[model samples]
Target: MDALDDLDLRVSGCRACPRLVDWREEVARTKRAAFADQTYWGRPVPGFGPPDARLLIIGLAPAAHGGNRTGRMFTGDRSGDVLYQALYDVGLASQPTSVAADDGLELYGVRVTAPVHCAPPENKPTPGERETCRPWLVQELRLLRPTVRAVVVLGAFGWQATLPALAEAGWRVPRPRPAFGHGVRVGIDRSEGSVGGGGPAGLDLFGCFHVSQRNTFTGKLTPAMLREVLSTAARAAGLGK
Candidate 1:
């Protein structure tokens, strides 16, 4: 198996965090009423996309009834619905809907992942949990570094988590760090010490509001806004407009 595939297998088998392990298994057993007949994946979700993807999208932890149930990042939830649709509109995804792992949907030049793989209670992973789960992200970043040139981070949590992982994976993250805000973009170089920006081989980091029900339902993040962000990031990743 390829390194990315092997890493994914390891990630899915992770049971390092006691609370997450118990909670994920419990949620699987209880089974949401709407999906009672369906079998939950009940394991940590892994990054989904081609290993040579030039663009990467980072999100918060998987949703309890979403990735935790479907075994794919950003699948089986309203958030995924919003995200995949935007990706499709921008030509980054084959379809606008991501309902299940084997649904035949595909991403073009893009990969979707998260800082935390497990479904945290209330969608909030504790600080300790994030730290415990970070090695997996670090390893994934290292593996993707050769081709990944741009990143779109959804939400403040992902932004905070990704910077450290990026630094550890060989990028020179700016000091005082870049703040998280919709439409914010920061350039990161492969070497440390200098932080001018827009280096030829550097990575571009774009910030976007999370595609959560809260943001979408309140119109804080509209379809047009999401598409704009995805399109801009895709272009920066050399995926064409």
Candidate 2:
């Protein structure tokens, strides 16, 4: 509750990334006629899951009508719909739907969050924007301390953002590790924390092509592809059924 409470406050009026803030606000303003009464929360979106979550799902920025509209990470988007369905299949999520705030979705031990909170114009965030958005991620990781067993990065950028934290926490990569693809897993030696007593544990990082239209339409990512990654992460996190 402590960490979640702090994150809620931190995300309320976030201005860490000026470019994203300005762009998000502009988009909200220009489309105000239609969404004015909708209460656009053009602020940092917080992670959703358990305080002692064992799995971390990393994604890119929110979409215009996705998390940006629903105010919950990954909600109200095609990507989220697919993701939640997969999580439901793996026994992590109770609902196969994540369409809106009232979807009543619940994650067992999985947390979902985006690299960038504010939805960028055209869904592409600049490198400067990514840099500006890094701090919140760092803070989030710190608060998530002991329970994280593996991080399932949804794309290249998500992997990149998570790598440094893994490194500083004493994680190491093996030689000839392949680039991100569906069902790729890399185990890292980490010193973040253990269940209770402070100790070292291996953090498994699984990578998959994002569930975006670009990948899904091209068949680069499919339900089978994503499910493989999910199974791998679950096995690593000791959540296997």
Candidate 3:
């Protein structure tokens, strides 16, 4: 397989964080009452999308019963319901729902990933765990740097995590770093200089509230709001033309 495939395979096998490994495996074995008959992936979830994508979406981490069970980022959860529907509405995704890894949902020119690959307890990954998982994201960003033109970071946690990874991947994150805010957009330039003589390739970074039940249920993030952000980022990535 290629570099991305290799990276993904490696990601799926990671057990670097003892806490996350224990939590994820326990959750998998216990099995949610609704899904008792189903088998859980119970491993580090890999990034989902084509290798050379133009748009990247960053999330905090997998939900305990969501990605940890489905084995795909943003799958089998209410959060995924909001995210996928918005993506589909903006013409970035082939389907309006993401239930399973084998669901056949396709993302056009976009990839989805997280700072922490495994689901964390109480949906919160410790700072140490986040750091431990950084290498995988750093490598994934490097692999996508040539083609990725824009990124949409969901939630402040993802926004904070991704800025450092972006800098490590070749982009020059601004001094003071951009603050995370819904509907925020920042332009980042390549620190290493031009790409294909393209005069210092840059990337568009957009921020959106997390599509968690807390946000959606409270109307902190509406369908229209989510779509607007995705559409804007999709256009920046030269998609939907």
- List the candidates' TM-scores in order: 0.95, 0.88, 0.96
Residue 227 displacement in candidate 2 (angstroms): 1.2
Error of 1 at 116 (Å): 0.2
Alpha-carbon RMSD, candidate 2? 2.9
User: Any idea what lDDT model 1 has?
Assistant: 0.91
Instruction: List runs of model 3 lying over 4 Å from the truth.
Output: 193-200
lDDT of 3 by residue, 81-200 (tens): 999999999998999999999999999999999999999999999888888999899899888877999999999988878988888777888999999999999999877653333333
Q: Write the per-residue lDDT of candidate 2 for residues 1-241, one digit (tens) a residue.
A: 4866687678757887777788777765565455566766556677888877888899988877677777788887788888988888888898899977777888988889877788888899877777677777766765665677888999998777777655544445554544776567777765544433564456788888898988888888888888878877977787745
Candidate 2: misplaced stretches above 4 Å? 32-37, 169-178, 192-200
**Best-fitting candidate, scored by lDDT:** 3
lDDT (CA) per prediction: 0.91, 0.76, 0.92
Candidate 2 lowest-lDDT run of ten:
191-200
Per-residue lDDT for 77-175 in model 1, tens only?
999999999999989899989999999999998999999999999999988899899889988888887789999999999999999988877788999
What would the TM-score be for candidate 3 when compared with the true structure?
Answer: 0.96
After the best TM-score superposition of candidate 3, give how far the Cα of residue 193 lies from its true spot, in angstroms. Answer: 5.7
Better of 2 and 3 by TM-score: 3
